[model samples]
Target: MSVDVEGKSLVDLLDMLEPAPVPEPISMVPQTWGWSVLALILAGLIILGVYAFLRHRQFNAYRREALIELAASDNNAAKVAEILRRTALVAYPRRKVAALHGKEWTNFLNQTSDNVTFTDGAGRQLVEAPYRDVKADPDLEILARNWIKSHKRERTA
Candidate 1:
């Protein structure tokens, strides 16, 4: 190693008189704004759900239609009652026939319409009517059959 003598070190230090510049500290802390953003996302999701509900007001429209076909093809009272209950749910969802059990189902059928005669009024069973009636509603039956035929023809074509 070459050694510098004290006599040679005097030239470089005398020319520099300015202080060194200091750097600003950069923060790397985690974000705290996620809660509000998450809440907004949740609100948007709720609005989208409400919009979908309004669009498809009747959840069981297609189900009732299919049940109607089953009742028509079978000409069974049980099938008719099931379809009627589905129709009732679509029409009056708050008074859901699907929730009925035992005697309540029978009662519901009697109270809802004279068009539907039930063995029991309160516990309106879905199927007992078709089996007991022996004579089905021919007008409704014909209409259902025609509807089924039309649908079948449309599908095939």
Candidate 2:
């Protein structure tokens, strides 16, 4: 079945031809765009998480200090009242908080929350009690702490 090729066999002729060149090995190093984009997104998320953590700590710093002072007061009504006043000052304007007295001060405190009413409730003692040399009510301390923890900054008229 072989054709004559200058008296050489077809197999010999075929063998004399060069074999197809093997494709050059593909480059081993991967393309950088995909890896670079993935790394950038990962870095952004890490930075966002760190920022959120730091902002949260900063926001709670006031509450932590208020609790520490409340604990140190040790049932002293005058001291507790002073601490409350100082805490309020930080969150409210000086004029709005400075001149408040007795029922007015308690009313202001009550306005900030629905959970604790300072005027006609357990917190009534915060008014007259501070003026006298009386031991602070533990319940009032708890109420004040709760209010400080959850009170919104919006003032109620």
Candidate 3:
């Protein structure tokens, strides 16, 4: 029998197989529209999450600010009175404590200051001034101011 000349056998040459070719990636964007719908759903969820977070933060911040103001303030009751007045201002934008006079003003004031007695005449109007008017009683102003410290209601506290 004749021997192989170089070295490796014919068996080694036949044992090796060719490597498989890599497949190209298919483009889903051009083929199907489902990806766009999924993207829109994700975007909507993101927007909703952001809006909720912002609103919660705003509410917390408002509560914190109110607490800080109350802590620093010497008068708590009067602060509550002012807060109520501000609420009323938002509720009824047309007639404010300053612009309103007579029975209308008294009725508005009565809601906040429950203890004070009022007459049909200039009773309510007398105490309607923001900065102590001649007709408005100074003692009543002091009473309202004192009440501010007592009436302040905080969410956190």
Candidate 4:
């Protein structure tokens, strides 16, 4: 069991042993780009959503101002009528709203906003309320504000 190896050279001993196998170099991370592409797409969608929200707020900026003015005004009837007229003028042509009188004006208001009937409901007060000493319907104020906030503009040629 005790063999002598004093005469053997280091190269002969190394040549006698088997060589260690060389491993192929490998990358730890996968090569797929789907995750980065998905992240970029998600970021783009969020940016587009925020931009759409800001644009919508800008488009309805006038409604917010009118509501605030309506809330702060002392003369409810005159202010309500004025706000409606001004809003109509902005939405429609001047000729359409300029000469409307009494019931016709109320009817126009109702047509513009299908949610409330201005002619038959509390909005009828707007006809004579501005000219004479008349008490404005408290409900009309709420209805008008809601209409102004939610009314969709009609396209006129």
Candidate 5:
């Protein structure tokens, strides 16, 4: 069975039909201002954290150098003493550290560190080891390494 289109042509039928709706293109940009603001804040925080980490590493570079020198000294007491002196010079004022020697130097070492004692402990080697013919004590190297790693910075005021 078929219905007859007596008066209409194919072109006329096509033109009479409604056009299909076109959907709006989805936006790539964020819909809200708050989302954009949050993204910027997150980027800024990431940059700040990276900067702080790099500065911390740079500030502690002296400690890393001193430790390397200590390892290369091979338990030579004179070399160890020189390394400790040089490290102290970098950590403290030149005037305060440059003139210290013998017992004063040992006392300064003890004062700066909370855990290690240079006066009566293995650190005493620093005082007399360089001048005397005494054999190098392994403990002296360990003590120096500990002091170099953990010694507190001097207060500026």
Candidate 6:
């Protein structure tokens, strides 16, 4: 069943209708310039933070290597002393560290580290270990590891 348009032609029917209202298209980009600038700054800061973290890890790679060598020394005093000296050379100037020996070396270790163990404590064994038949002292190993972990780096002018 249909209602017939008695007087209207197809062109007349088309002319009688109006166009539907169209909505504005939504934008995916941020609308405000401030928001865009803030987003760029935040992204740049994140990138900078990641770069700094990676550089810090790379700078401290020597510490990781020294710790590994310390672990592998098997509590041998001479080996522990050598490892500590090599680690010191990496952290300090070659002229200052390479020439250090005996009590002078122990004093230098004490000066660089937080604890005084290197001067009078278990670390004294480092001075004698290389020169004489010294027993492997676990405390000396611990002291050497502590020094390696805690020693301050020399400041460059």
Query: Using lDDT as the measure, which candidate wins?
Result: 5
* lDDT on C-alpha atoms for all candidate structures: 0.52, 0.82, 0.50, 0.79, 0.88, 0.85
In candidate 2, which residue pairs get closer than 3 Å at backbone N, Cα or C atoms, i.e. clash? none
Is 1 or 5 the stronger prediction by lDDT?
Answer: 5
Q: Give the higher-lDDT candidate: 1 or 4.
A: 4
TM-scores for every predicted model: 0.32, 0.70, 0.35, 0.71, 0.76, 0.77
lDDT (Cα, tens digit) per residue for candidate 6, span 21-57: 9999999899989999999999999999999999879
Clashing pairs in 6: none
**How many clashes in candidate 2?**
0
Over 4-45, each residue of candidate 3 has an lDDT whose tens digit, in order, gives: 446666776555545789899876674557878888999999
Quality of model 1 by C-alpha lDDT = 0.52
lDDT of 3 at 4: 47
Ranking by TM-score: 6, 5, 4, 2, 3, 1
- Model 3 worst lDDT window (10 residues): 148-157
Displacement of residue 26 (Cα, Å) in model 3 is: 4.9
Positional deviation of residue 27's Cα in model 1 after best superposition, in angstroms: 87
Predicted candidate 5 versus true structure: per-residue lDDT over 1-157, tens digit per residue:
4655579999987777778999999999999999999999999999999999998798789999999999998788888998999899988999999988889999999899998888876778888876875556888888899999999977565
Please give the distance, in angstroms, between residue 114's alpha carbon in candidate 5 and its true position after superposition: 1.3
lDDT for 143 (candidate 3): 43
Pairs that clash in candidate 5: none
lDDT of 5: 0.88
Over 4 Å off, model 4: 1-31, 155-157
Better of 1 and 2 by lDDT: 2
* Off by more than 4 A, model 2: 1-32, 154-157
- Write candidate 4's Cα lDDT for 21-69 as tens digits: 9898897654689877887899999999999999878877888888888
